[model samples]
Target: MATFAQDDDGVVVIIGSGAGGGTLANALAKQKIRSVVLEAGKRHSLEDIENDEWAMFKKISWLDKRQAAGGWHLTENNPTLPAWIVKGVGGSTVHWAGIALRFRDFEFRMQSINGDIAGANLLDWPVTLEEMAPWYEKAEKHMGVTGPSTGMAYHPWHNSFKVLATGAKRVGYKEILSGPMAINTEPYDERAACQQLGFCMQGCKMGAKWSTLYTDIPRAEASGYCEVRPQSMVLRIEHDAKGRANAVVYADASGTIQRQKARVVCVAGNSIESPRLLLNSASAMFPDGLANSSGQVGRNYMTHTTAGIFAVMPKPVNMHRGTTCAGVISDESYNDPSRGFVGGYRLEILALGLPFLSAFLDPTPKGWGKQFTSRMEKYNHMSGVWLCGEDLPLENNRITLHDSEKDQYGLPIPVVTKSDHPMDAAMRKHGVAATARCYEAAGATDIIELPPYPASHNMGTNRMSAKARDGVVNKWGQSHDIPNLFVSDGSQFTTSGGQNPTLTIVALALRQAEQIGRLLNERAI
Candidate 1:
């Protein structure tokens, strides 16, 4: 409920109130640093959340104008929308699957582990796992993840996970467990425990899942130093004559354009929109676009290599009875180039309702037939596993501004261009085959391979680098070209590791907030 003046230049102006922005704002508030979060979507409440998947998707998913090109599997299925990001005050955290995982040591050093791979723009993270461990611990405790860091036990194996585990154990999978999840196994952070409601993709109504919508944003506002302005879509970042970003132009809730002064500006609008906003903020000094000195602002885009395997059991598995994504098979999650690829992958057990499955069963022209209907009719007998792996960054696979296409705000629409690397193909092939083996071992009558879905774990767009020539941001997510501008989101990932990204994003934001606080106290803006 706290509000800062529009002309207040002493406050930090953070764009997008999601995992990154929301966490940063709250962390900074603890240090008594004021911030104003401008979110481009409505402020949703627990009352508005529902268990209906498609209905909730309509309410929260970002359906804005975006063009997807290249061989991305979602091109044929979801051409206009390539990323399944959420738009609301809490950003995509409102729709996340509650999977919390930290990057392994080898993953943070992708360049060193996989050397000189052709067509791969690999780089070691300027910050290492050793440096991030404490931050990761803090994030886990803060989010109440089911882990020892939080003094909580992991979630019990759900039916879908049980089905997958039955076959996985028989197939020699060792590292199998109900992995760390952000959902509360027991009520720890004032949030209620999960009641085994199936539609986790739909926003959690029980508040068991960690979401900035009900956690960080409210706590930051309660501190009386932060204000969240919903439906404020930023158009451009304006820099002073000294080339320091000092303000942003945005359309308010009523469609009125307004300028908000800032001491610092942080962009956390996910990957695609974050780069698009920076690219749209071109000025005479930054003609190539703001903070694009290395031409890396929108380059090196990566969405984790992903796919799925659905198995039809002879008996009713009743997969859709518990949390959607709690089981993980991480036997392959290591630096094993011997597996026909450089990086590694993990097989995560997940279940979807019939509605979502039918749409993604086969997204071709002749997708629906009696055969498809027959498979869907036995929903209770089906169990699925999602395959995800490290997607090596490719400089040409990027987000670009369309020359002629414009949205309701008249800003050029973003075009996402992607082509799978050879490594990506090898990883996907191995992952799919390994996952199918698990189901086939578990007495699966039939198996179906599903192509990659839209980009959910998007990363590496405005990536971090040790030097200014290589990327847009530095170790602290500060813009290399503009000192006061920062990217506080997954877009600052130097490389995409084989894990869910939300936990890492939150940890990085918490770490960045400490640095920003020290700099603010030293008057180093």
Candidate 2:
């Protein structure tokens, strides 16, 4: 609620108030650091959250004009809307399913372990799991992650999860459970426990699932060190003669351009917009893009190789009665090239309601005949898992500023170009077949394999690296070119680990905030 001056150069300006930005704001506020959080969309409170899928999509989703290219299914099915992220105060956390998982050790060392994957731009993260464990613990505790030692029990297995685990067991898999989720199994954080409502992606009405909207942003505001400005679409980053980022120009809620001075700027605008903002910030000193000396600012885009596998069970599964991401089967979450892929995947319960299912079940022209009708009719008897796996970073798989198109604010629209690595196709084919076998063992009368939907798991555009020449940011997420500038979102990822990105994004933000606070005190940055 506190408003600072437009020329307040001491404030750290954070763009996009999602998991990373919101979490970073609160973390910095805890240490009495002032920050301005500028979100692109209007704010929505818990009271405004609706359970209806289409209604909520219109309300929260960032339906910006993002074009898709390359061979990804989304290029064909969702070209103009390549991502399904939220644009409000909490960013995509408002639309997240709360299936939090930590990055495995091998994931952090992909380049070292994989020893050079052909055509895959692999790199070891500058920070290791050993170094990140404490931060992850802090994030887990702060977010009230539901699991052992957190004083919150794991979520009880819902019908969808039950079917998943049963099928997983039948297929010789063991790592199956319904949690480590940010959703509360019991009320811990001041919020109410989940009401067993299933419209999690629509925004949690109970506030049980952790979202920065009701959690971090409010906490940051309560600390009196953070000011959240909703509907402030940042158009460019500005710098002085020395080329240090000093301010950002954005359109205010009233559609008037405003410049907010900053001592430091953190771009936490998710993967797409984060890099887009940097590319749009191109200056005479850094003509390629701000902090883009390595030409990696908008390169190496990654969305986990993903698919939705729906099965028609013999009995009513009522999958839509509980959490959307009920549980995860992480047995496949390992680095096993013997499986025809360098990295692994996780099978988590994904229960989409009728409306979501109808649109995403299949996007082909022949999608609506008997096959679709049969599946639609058996909604009550359906169980499914979202197959999310590692997506190797390729330099060509990137987000680029469109040469011609621009948004309403006169910025070049970001074009997300993605395609499958041979590994991606192999991994997905294997994952789908394995998922089908599991469902078949559990008595699936029919199975429908769905192509990847608009990616909710975007990462690796402005990635971190030990060497400045290899990436945009360092181990601390501080830009190599501009020490005071940072990337606090999933964009800082070195690799797209085989799981959800939110937990890791929060962990990195927490760690980066500490580093930022320390550097501020030391006058190092």
Candidate 3:
């Protein structure tokens, strides 16, 4: 509700309103600093959120023009739809499943613990897990995560979770339980308890799930220090003669160009768009891109090596009656190269509606015959799990600008290219075998291994490093080349761990806010 002048050069301008940007806005507002948030999509309230997957996805997903390349199957099955990020006021937070998790200690030091792996661009994070523990605690409490930290009870196990737990136990897996989640169990932070409507990915209409749309953004606006401008698509960042970012040019709802000056600019537009924006902002001084002195702005892209396993039970399981990701089996989520892979993965309970199952169960052109129809007929008898594993980053797996393609705004479209490392294949194969065994232990009659879906966990495009020569950002997510520029999203990840990225993104944003507040107080920007 508070508005600043277009030419006001004192307010911090944040480029997205998802977990990182939204949390950063509220954190800075709590410090009595003003900020302006420019979101590229329309603002949708709880009333506007639908419980239908296809409807809500069409309503909020970022369906902009993008191309897929490399040896990944998605390049052939879904060439134009590489990633599945949202483009609304709350960004992908509105569509997240609320599986809040922290990275393991070894995951933070991948290069050191795993040594040099072939064809992988591994690096230890500039900040370690021990240093991030306090921030993770703060983020968990702030988001009202239901776990031991908040003393909030976890949601009662649904039938599907019961099935998963039984299978996991029979398969000799120990660490089986409903992991930490951001969805409310008992009423907390003025939100209602989850109704278990089984539509979390469609957007939590009951206000039980933590989303910036109903949490951080509203809180920041209530403090009278943050102004959220939706339907404003950023074109490029403008830098002053001294190479400090000073302004941002974006297109308004009416397709009119508007410029907002800023003292600091944080790019939190997810991994793909964040890197694409920097690459599009090239100038005479920085021909490669702004803050891309190391030419790593759009390299080392990672989306968790993922696969979906669905099993057919003799009895009706009604898997789609609870949260999208009901529980997790984390016994295998540790590093053990003896398992034929450098990294590990988690088997999380997943249930997709019939519509999504039909589309993603087998994405091949000839997959719609009798075999696929038979699987759909057993919808109520199906139980599923999604394998989320650490995918090693490669220098060639990246986001690049198209040579000739352009969007409606005359900006070059982004082309996401990814190829599987041998490690990724090995981990995915191990996960499939483990998941099938668990289902078989539970008396599953048939099992099917689904290929990777459109990427939901995008990371590692503008990563952080201890030395400026290795990455684009520093320990604080501040650009190594541009002092006033920052990356407040998952794009700053040094390596993607075997966990959902929302928790770490929020934690890092809180840490970045503290550093930014200190820099502001000392007039160091």
Candidate 4:
């Protein structure tokens, strides 16, 4: 692995090594640009991945102390853990289920299509889908997505998908199939095919999933232009007198504060921490926060309006015998205000292990009664679907620093406050109804409508806009206030599109890498 000195002022310092930061580091390395990636978790090898859900979760999840507020049920249900992000070198990519998807055309221009929806912070992305098409293709190829675009075979349908597809067809749905997934269907990219272990969210033990821990990060190191430093938690980004980002201060693994000088800094610490880092970096020049001139740095936070629906089949379905979220039904994933919702959502096949089922079955205090035990007993006959919907951005739904609470590093902990827009509730109701009808059509005995679980798709905090006053970053994800600063994560999303954000996050990182590289060559920063 490559190593760089702390005072390497020419190196680009990127915080977090997730889908965006990890991909950006490798992309920059490909352009012969040096970067130092700071990951705030312990490094783990393929041998460390486990097939057990709870075990792997304990091993990789970002178990940091965070608070949740506002009207979102998570405050009461999961107050301390509102988001389900990972820590380690690969970030949440290590725990992702590899469902790669792209946003629809109208999704990029939500405000244009919806036309001034009240109480919603609808804004069109500075970059269009047409502009991102090539990047999306590159991302698909790089991730080895199993789809027609890559000429890669999709995984064989497991019994869980069969049940979901059967129900979907019965309910008059057409686009029901195992959708584009980053998990390999056959040997490709020097990675093995998925071993049908059914614990994809836990981490792929067979190296079949496209995680930066085994892919882009190593490739970047091999290029000898990128250095990934794990167990380094960035505390703040520092800028010069002219307001250009110059260095990052982080705590090393030994709890020693170290400063790494840089020409450019990219923050990709997931949506929550990404903005928290900026807010914590407030200074005399940018008193509110770095690059927070518009006061939008931590506003418009979104996690896909989501819900889980599990149905008990008359016969044994054994939904947990295969991949976690490979099956998808996209018939409803289009804009149609006639459905009482401005945006749309997709119903993807989902399965949880017994442990998670027991917990998420009911998050209430007295949720472990006979009813819960009875539901666990019917686990073998259960089939489930997760609703991935577009969560409308509200200016008030944001991440703010806690009043007094501090973390291990003494930085104020972030309080994620979110509330469901009326549209969100309408869309979720529509999804639950449609999903229940599908299950009923397939002769399901009973159905369980699970509330939103800990957020898996975190997006939209430091979003992009054509005008600097409208957002924190520009189309290239460069900070409007700090020329040398950038947001290389899902936090740069203009709107929460109805798709798994990993693909778009990688595409944006790839695109940003090119822009940053060009700027470096031109000495624009």
**What does candidate 1 score on TM?**
0.99
TM-score of each: 0.99, 0.99, 0.99, 0.99
Clashing pairs in 4: none
Overall lDDT per candidate, in order of appearance: 0.91, 0.91, 0.93, 0.93
lDDT of residue 194 for candidate 3:
84
lDDT of 3 by residue, 261-373 (tens): 99999999999999999999999989999999998999999999899999999899998898778699999999999988877799999899988999988998878889889
Off by over 4 Å in 3: none
Name the weakest run of 10 consecutive residues (lDDT summed) in model 1.
70-79
lDDT of 2 by residue, 332-391 (tens): 999999998888999888999999899989886678888678879999999998999999
- Local accuracy of candidate 4 as per-residue lDDT tens digits, 1-525: 789999989999999999999999999999999999999999899899877778888999999899999998899999999999999999988988799999999999999998988899899999999999999999999999999767889889999889889988997999987969999988989999887889898678888989989999999999999999999999999999998999999999999999999999999999999999999999999999999999998999999989999999999998889888989999999999999988889998999998889889888786777988888899999999999999999999999999999999999999999999999999999999999999998999999989898998999999999999999999999999888999999999999999999999999999999999999999998
| Residue 232 lDDT, candidate 2, scale 0-100 | 98
Off by over 4 Å in 2: none
Error of 3 at 138 (Å): 0.6
lDDT of 2: 0.91
Candidate 1 Cα outliers beyond 4 Å, as residue runs:
none
